[model samples]
Target: MKAKYLVLSFFFFTAGTLFSQNKSVPKSIIKQNASILKFYDKKELQSMQKGQLLVLYVERTKTLIKTLPYIALASKPGVTMVDLGIPFTSENISLLDTQHDATDKFLDITTEFQKGMLPYSDKESLIKAILFYESVLKQMHELNEQE
Candidate 1:
């Protein structure tokens, strides 16, 4: 009987904790839906004020983060395609090298995107392309925020 009572109390304690947590959201904020979120509309310069905006952005961007890994095409194995012969066997390459190439590709592709350098059916090419831009934004934000 005592063991049963203890178990029930523990369960209630855990349930209470979970309910309190769900009720009080410090980090996550919920918001209404947006009509459109396009390539150009992606730029959000305004400071976030409303809980709803935070929710929308978080949900949308969580989707984006989930999509990011899928967005990146596996780098083709070659010296010529990468063009610099940067030997990366995915073991010992430095991040600085990767950043340089990614940044260059970003600038190159932004021009290409405007001029239609790449064909249409590249399979999430645009998302991966924008990843570079987003990466830069994240880095800048982190740097400013001392992250």
Candidate 2:
């Protein structure tokens, strides 16, 4: 009899504690069905955002590429050019190196994307892609903002 009573008391105490721990959320903030999120689950929504950022990055890179001079392409094949004694300072060399690195990184990402190297499933590949895309997008945003 004592054991049964003790078990009942412990059950009631646990139930009461659990019930108290659950805080009530205000009804006003909770929508029955938000149309904006009607179709997309959290992962899909995140993937969509990453896709948008990639598109933006591609667009910006395209613009940048356009603005760059195509001097090498314009030059005739087997043509030897005389040195103009162009001065290359350390700072200028480093700046050009950094620019080339950024362009190469962007090209690498786009090439991988075009090859369908990133699997869009809710698996490890997709998660890693999402993180990579997010970081790239963040870097682009910061550079744009600075400019």
Candidate 3:
């Protein structure tokens, strides 16, 4: 019985660690992916280079708004560790659930963007669909700033 209890506890700990990492991660991850943004595009990303400029040239006095609030609104279960300084962990949902089957289209878009391939040939449509993801990420950034 003692040996069995030890084995079960070990499995639980390992599972918990995996779950935590999947949910939260850390800030360096965002900066790292942001650097790879150029590679995420399949066609000429030159158009988005201009969008990058929108981020750079935008005025500072515009007042930083809460992006995480919108994100938390979407997630429904609400955020975890608003004090953790990393937003995406508890604030995002698993796409695997039935009630959230709505996330499939979004997930498919991300898979295509990251791999730089269209599962189908409709590259433009995939790119357009990817825009919805940006808003979620932007909200995560807002949470980061809030922290």
Tens-digit lDDT track for model 2 on 30-66? 1122111122233653556545534433443443342
lDDT of each: 0.38, 0.42, 0.37
How many angstroms is residue 118 displaced in model 2 relative to the true structure, after the best TM-score fit? Answer: 12
> What's the lDDT of the predicted structure labeled candidate 2?
0.42
Top of the candidates by lDDT: 2
Clashes of each: 1, 0, 1
Q: How many backbone clashes does candidate 1 have?
A: 1
Per-residue lDDT over 1-147 for candidate 3, one digit per residue giving the tens place of the 0 to 100 score: 999999999999999987775434222211111211222333443355544423321111011111222344322223333433444443343421332343335444554463453343343544444443444444554553574
lDDT-sorted candidate list, best first = 2, 1, 3
lDDT of 1 at 88: 42
How does candidate 2 fare on TM-score? 0.26
Higher TM-score: candidate 1 or 3? 3
State, as a TM-score between 0 and 1, how close model 1 is to the true structure.
Answer: 0.22
Superposing all C-alpha atoms, what RMSD in Å does each candidate have to the true structure?
Answer: 18.7, 24.9, 11.6
Q: Measured by TM-score, how close is model 3 to the native structure?
A: 0.26
Q: How accurate is candidate 3 locally (lDDT)?
A: 0.37
